[model samples]
Target: MSFDEDNSPFGAGVPSDVYQTSIREPVSLEVPEDVNPEAVQPNTSIENESPVNTPPNGPPLADWSSGISIIEAGKSTEGASRGYIAYTIKLGENTVRRRYSEFESLRSILSQIFPLLLIPPIPGKSFNLKLLATPPPNGVDTETKLVEQRKKMLQLFLKECLKMEQVRDTQVFHRFLDPNSNFNEDLRTGEITDLPLNPLCSNPFNGLDTYKNILYSYLPPEVHTTSMDLESLHLQQEDNTKQTSLYEYISLYTHIISSADLSFSHDFDKANKKVSTTARKLTDYYTQCGNSFNSFSLSEPGTELSLLLERIGTSYDQVYLIEEGFIEFIEKRFNDYWKFYLQCFGTIRDVLAFRELKGRQCEYIRSSLASKETAWQAFQKSDDESQRLTQAIRKSEGVASKHRLLLEPSLDVRFVPITVPNPPSKKKGAFSYSLSAFSKLKSTIADVITLQPELSREEQTAQLQTQINVLRQCLILAESDISKMDEFINEQFHLYHDEKLVFMRGLLREYCRHLVEVNEKCAEVWLETKAEIEGLGL
Candidate 1:
């Protein structure tokens, strides 16, 4: 499948085949031999559509206005020999089946395609690793619990993706939900491959843009520093008198979220697991107490006391059932929610890491330019010295030529080789010293000329200047990228914070509501028991 300039599978003005209204239902897991898969279509009639109810103080419901649901999950009949489960997704009247690996691919592609956006996490492959490693015997349905959990989490994943406009509008996303569309084929030849191998080195908004890719390529290779290393560096920078740039500040923020004292994932995991463990213990105690009361009541069979004890035992049973529901709620809502945010922490770190790399790229370019400039200056000094030496040698030659001309005109006046026989031994004088110095100077100039680079000094200077100019351009682009990234990350952080607050508010509200319900039912049970005891006149 080919993507257009806008990254849509269909070119501009071509309406997508995907239905505008999203509603889904699960069909039978077993595909019939005679049934045509292409014939199945989601109902798009307006009358059949139902309004969506959004919770108060929650995220905006626009993205989820068109609901996506996982109707059922079962082993694929076509792949029965290998035995992998497939989840049936329904949106409006449209339905499609996808495997866990497909969901993995989808998320991977989305992250690369939109690195700046927050991509939701899916249940890891480890969740069903056992089932995959050893498929059940034919017709056997083992690991139903794992499959059920995956279905719930995957459904949540789709809904979360729908909440983001950028994610929902993507052609790949729509194709994944299109029953007739070949999603795997599209994935193989998708626009994502056209992007730079490093997602950070591509346009955040449009990775396929060649011009943007070229500019981004100027960025330095990604730094492989660990979180601890980054944290240490950040602290060192903080200690300096110089103010931290936005990128450094973001790095520090992400480090704190992922690894520091303010780590949400770490704290949430600890708290959530503690709650689950405590609930399990409470349920176990209730079970034991209920059994004990029942056993004791049997000794007083047919007595009013026996009935009273039985009633009390029944209350314990009721409370146990309520607690069991509460446990399920915690697992589904709180535990899963924590896992989602944990994945988000990873994504946040990756984004900040990209920014860090870009910042480093800028630094690298500046350093390169500085070194080039220094080399150029040194070359200029040498060139100037060479010029002065050449001018001095020419002046000396001109004086020698003038003397030769005058001597040639007086050739007849002749001469003599008269030598002062007993001339005092010539003392080392200024004239001799000057002659020695001139000889040394001539050699120095010769060495300078001979030791010159293969390229002329002018050419060498031009080359260095060229390199400096390229580095300067790269620095400009790197800085621009960093600035854009900073703004985008900041905006996303705010959005994430808002969503987190809404999610936590809803979570706590539901938790309290469930607790109130359990208490109310328990109170009614005890009140009935009291009324019965009074009726017995005990």
Candidate 2:
């Protein structure tokens, strides 16, 4: 198979003879209790076609429905004899059969169409090990369970597709729903087409700005203002701080575990070396004791002494054997086990950490949006109050009370340095202006409009809005990343389990080997002891 720049599949298209759509009544094939319906099936035809229903104002909707039933029990290409699910998919008025892989292909295409979405995880097509290892008496039921699982997963895949309007309304999706249609073939031939994008949804994958705009487009117009109140900004700042906590937790876990793995590995290796060294030294000591016994003469007392020394040397040899066993079984075996153990630990830790990391990123997105929304509302409310106060002053037509103009509004006011003109009449005490001065005050207040606060509010609002957008993009990116991680896990799950299987096999092999070696060594030791006793004439 070949792939396009977008990683879409393009290869040998389905044969022209197989291009026909299948339409038939829903067919049901009973599956046995022991065999999984998802195990296998021959590519059987149930072809038909129906007209597409075009709506007056929206995209054309195809009357697609789906059903699943067990098909004939047969040997799958994988050589497993199991029942197959005859998934009946209805597009318009036509129905046909499909395999689970078809469902996977459909999901893959939809993922490309909506890159930002978390395409729900799919069950891997490979057989579960339990099913493969089941005894014949119990095999059928395990297969049945697997089949059921696959059915549910396939259903979930379809359900998720229906949830997304972009996917559900697409002609290509309907074609996929059509059991007779070769969706993969269409993809290979580049005949697959997507429905028009929703007006509110910009191509999220295009760039950061587009992604941000897509999020903004979802907000209500009333709370869409670019202004923010100081109070709301403060609240948002608190939430932003809260978002960091998850990050810190993830970082701490990764750092600690990674460091611990290295340190523990070193310590374990050191312990192994010590055990091996002890084993070697003990063996040498036993050898020296045996050599010392050889120097004894064959006189009665000498012979007795030599025999006693030989017995002691034999007991020491047993001890030496035990020491060697410790090195071989405990030290060397554990060393090998620790390598894979650390690998497994790291894999599990990374998965968990990545999950938490995504969760933190999601929280940040939610909080940022919430803060922006709150600030926008507050700014609107504050703006409304200011406008109302200005309107009241204007309505008074220059006769409003000084206290009412300056105090009745109940605004948070701050004093700033302003140059005051000296009174022309040289009035003592406070030089007070008439009500006309209040008019200029009103215009001046209106002109500046809380100049510093306004500017600060605007800048904060802009910053919040931008963060909101970036965070939203991050959220989508998180979904994409986590989904990829899930796929990786699924793809490697069998290998992961196989690691355990391999370990168990190695353990069994080691046990057998040690058992045989111990048996042979005991025979050798017994034979030598018997020979020495005979030669001593004891």
Candidate 3:
């Protein structure tokens, strides 16, 4: 979602403002790591669109019927193996190999690797990768044509095998939405291995409200999902009944982003073809435009501008990665759910195989939006605040030039503190440890601000003063919510990224300092209600 114009931050529009607004270090591209030929376009038409690498900001959420992961695949540079990822998915593990002879083993492997897929299995219709590798009467193998026909199928196979570990993350999101689950049995593995609902249970999509109304209409009615209308998605009111946990929401968004990055919904040779084509294009595009982002407007220099902003905005590999990731997430999520379902209720084989997105509709979307919206809103607000402060500096400077000298620039500002209705108050010495940690952080941040070069004593003082206040406010905020960290987990599926989790962790960590207790009252209610449904309905 775009930031508000009126409340703009960073003086992006405030011409006179000198400070960098959306300030962050320039992140280096993965470079040779993402060597694709299509990325190069010696000549390009003017088209300002969402880069292939950027997330597709689609429509609001709806039901599962309205909820298809906006399939924005076919992007990404063949960015090589991530060290962290490689370590996480060590090969030769039971979770990685796809044993075709044993369907259960195959399914297990698929579930671990691909957790968000919704492909209807073409029963009795199976083909092996090894089969495709063999030569045939046609010189190449018949498997070549087979993969070319259903290219995405092969891509899907690789996606599950090579990435998407949602099945491995099952008990997480499930526990998050199902409040009845307990998280006391902390797993030292730093993941949710034990499911409170069914220590063995699991479940999968993208929020499809993005296509304006055109795409939304294409979805069937059986699916249930909440809209992602920007206004509705924002966690504005603390006590509002519509309020959802932000952590869960971010996890969902992360899934969508990952979906685009790892899309491989194609068949063998075709999937390889797709990969090769993309790789060729990327290599060309980047090779042509070396170290010159501003040289061309948006699209690279030599191709017909794509009409769709989603497609035009990013490089080919970026979008491809996202789509591959999305497909992989589905495959992984589904198997996790199925396995968990089997563990939770042995007799409901029918339900495990047949359940749709009808039941978890509202909560899924709600939680996703809630989680992500927090950071988005905060970032938005913070940006706006930064701009306002910068603008104020400009205005005050003009006035001072006319008048005289001053040692410190005082910025007495007013902010409407966001409230979380009856926010769990910090307990006595609850944040002692965090407080100690924060004190050091405060000094560090202060020093960093003080050290920013080339400022007059007056300006440096002003910046230092501003940083002190910001640091102090952040610490206080940390104290208020640190204790709720662990409790939030075992609850959310971690739809967001590390930033979102850290935010929650920070809050909970602060709270834990004072030995504050997490309120499981809400969780208790959720479990009982779910039990009743499983017992009577099943």
Evaluate all candidate structures by whole-model CA lDDT and list the values in order: 0.63, 0.47, 0.31
TM-score of 1: 0.67
- Ten-residue region with minimum lDDT total, candidate 1: 41-50
* lDDT-based ranking: 1, 2, 3
Candidate 3: residue 291 Cα off by (Å):
32
lDDT string, candidate 1, 1-538, tens digits? 3343332323331223111112223111112233322333221111212133332333333544467789998877565467677899976655789988889778766766676677877887764445644666752344766687788889888887888776655667766776776777775565544655555456655454533334455444343232333432232233352224443656655564656334444665577567679778988998999999999899999988898888888878987887789899887666666556556655665565555555554555666668777887888788889889989999999999999988885545478778878968868999999999999999999988888654665665665666555556656665655555556666677677677647766876886787678778768877887897788888
Tens-digit lDDT track of model 2 for 12-52: 32221111122323212112233322322221111112233
**315: Cα error in model 1, Å:** 3.1
Evaluated against the true structure, the overall lDDT of model 2 is: 0.47
What C-alpha lDDT, on a 0 to 100 scale, does residue 289 get in candidate 2? 69
lDDT tens digits, residues 45-66, model 3?
1121222221113221111112
* Stretches > 4 Å off in candidate 2: 1-285, 297-340, 343-347, 385-464, 487-494, 504-512, 528-538
**Which rank order by TM-score, best down to worst?**
1, 2, 3
